[model samples]
Target: MRSASAADFNATRFIARLRSRGLTWVLAIAVVLLQYPLWLGEGGWLRVREGAQKIDIQLALNQRLEVRNASLLAEINDLKQGRDAIEERARNDLGMVAPDEWFVRVVPAQSVQSGKTNE
Candidate 1:
């Protein structure tokens, strides 16, 4: 018959403890693997943050476009409602003349003489 010693008993107890802790070790490894994708992996937190910034930029661009559209709409309404607005733009841009209006031409004084003459 074999004799059981204290060392053998302790070794058996240690093996049992290790077996009990195996599930904890496996769970810890699983947590680390899962966190890789949530925090550091591709299509993870970093990518989500970048996407949020792009959305913010697009929203700002949309707001600017909306303001410009509103201003253009107001200008269009003014042009349609008021003949003065059309006439003002035409006179400023085209240099138009009415039938009874006289045109004035002012020449520079330097073109009047070739010599250095004081006014």
Candidate 2:
């Protein structure tokens, strides 16, 4: 057995000291193993964060769609309940006129002269 001397650096003693702290190394390895799934594995913190962001985007899109659907429903209700709405839509979309109304088309003088010249 070699006696411990203050001036002597011992590799055997250093290795024994490391072996004495074996429990600490085991606990550190266990911590790393447990943390692996929390940070990098499936359904981990990163995956949960990404899923939350997707849900937020989908919720925003649903809100916008709901608003659009509500506006469409209101327009449908207006068209169903009011003849004025129907008449306005017909006039704007189909260019319909009342039976008593006369339709007049105005042509520019330059266009008329250009047509005559082309002919």
Candidate 3:
């Protein structure tokens, strides 16, 4: 009968739709699995980028330390080569003076009113 053929046709269409949907879901899962290693694995882009950032930070620290070392070396050389630098440092830092001389300080009136003294 005509009603039986229509029922059969409807069942056929439903099966076809289910099969297509199954294939689509399988392909989607496959794509996700393939992308996992590229995005989250040990050799991924994020790890490489993180390593590059760490290298940059280390290089910057090394450069700053080199500059500091150079300045310290220069100071050491100056101290070793002459007594002038030592004498100046002693006079400024320790307030030292010659045995025959006196140490005098002159302060401004404004500093006195502000309650500030020489460090």
Best by TM-score: 3
TM-score to native of every candidate shown: 0.60, 0.69, 0.73
lDDT of 1 by residue, 1-119 (tens): 44578778889999999987997899999999999999888889999999999999999999999999999999899899999989888877887876888868666678667655433
Name the weakest run of 10 consecutive residues (lDDT summed) in model 2.
1-10
Q: In terms of lDDT, which candidate is strongest?
A: 3
Order of candidates by TM-score, top first? 3, 2, 1
Q: Is candidate 1 or candidate 3 better by lDDT?
A: 3
Q: Write one digit per residue (lDDT tens) for candidate 2, span 8-66.
A: 55876787789879978999999999999999999899999999999999999999999
Error of 3 at 103 (Å): 2.2
Write down the RMSD of candidate 3 (Cα, Å): 2.9
C-alpha lDDT (0 to 100) for residue 19 of candidate 3? 96
lDDT of each: 0.87, 0.89, 0.93
Please state every model's RMSD to the true fold in angstroms. Answer: 7.1, 5.9, 2.9
